[model samples]
Target: MSRPSVWAPKIVALIKGGNSSAAIAQIKVAPTVKDLQDLRKLLIAANLLKPHPNVDAATNDMIAELSAPRLHRSP
Candidate 1:
């Protein structure tokens, strides 16, 4: 089984405590794209963040970059 994320609880606590800036900082350094996405959802659900066009575009770009297949060069 997969291990739990280390940042989720901290982020949730920060959100609940109305510390959005700190939560955003933690989200910035989240280990995986899935973590980032999940944190974004939490922020939205808490009304701390809104889904703006620019933000969505940037997120989509990040998701694309992070999830894109890598090409291995011949050694």
Candidate 2:
């Protein structure tokens, strides 16, 4: 896998290990449309993402993606 693709398993392990990095970061807890798309990737890869693959992951992931301090937007 490429560097970016590898991030998925790491987050999955975090979830499987019962860690809440997002909560610790005080994530937004409710993401916007852009963050939702990002989170869907993570959750789906982690296999905790859905009964409906088309559905959004928990608001936490969305929030985490949305409100995690400052960051770059994909180009």
Candidate 3:
């Protein structure tokens, strides 16, 4: 993967603060769908996020994606 964006650390901080969705919203640039997905993966790998039972399938997929070794690097 390419070098992480400058916003990566900021996003991680928000996730660690337990406001992941808010972190997503804080992005200034128009990130692609995959970029947001990868941010979730980073949060998961950092053990700062978890799957909520009440969430939809897409969230569950994000949780599951981190359960596996998809990310080449840690957050």
Per-residue lDDT over 1-75 for candidate 2, one digit per residue giving the tens place of the 0 to 100 score: 633344334445555565655422322333243544554566667666454332333444555555566666678
Task: Tell me how many clashing residue pairs each candidate has.
Answer: 0, 1, 0
**What's the lDDT for residue 19 in model 2?**
61
Candidate 1 residue lDDT tens string, 1-75: 998676756676776786656655555555778876765676577665553434344445655666777687578
Off by over 4 Å in 2: 1-4, 22-75
For candidate 2, list the clashing residue pairs, or say none: 29-63
What overall lDDT goes with each candidate model?
0.61, 0.47, 0.54
Which 10 consecutive positions of candidate 2 have the poorest summed lDDT? 22-31
lDDT of 1: 0.61
Candidate 3 residue spans exceeding 4 A from truth: 1-3, 18-21, 27-30, 51-75
Candidate 3 C-alpha lDDT tens digits along 1-75: 787665556677765666746654454342444555665567567765544222223444544554566557777
Ranking by TM-score: 1, 3, 2
Tell me each candidate's TM-score.
0.52, 0.33, 0.43
Error of 1 at 27 (Å): 2.0
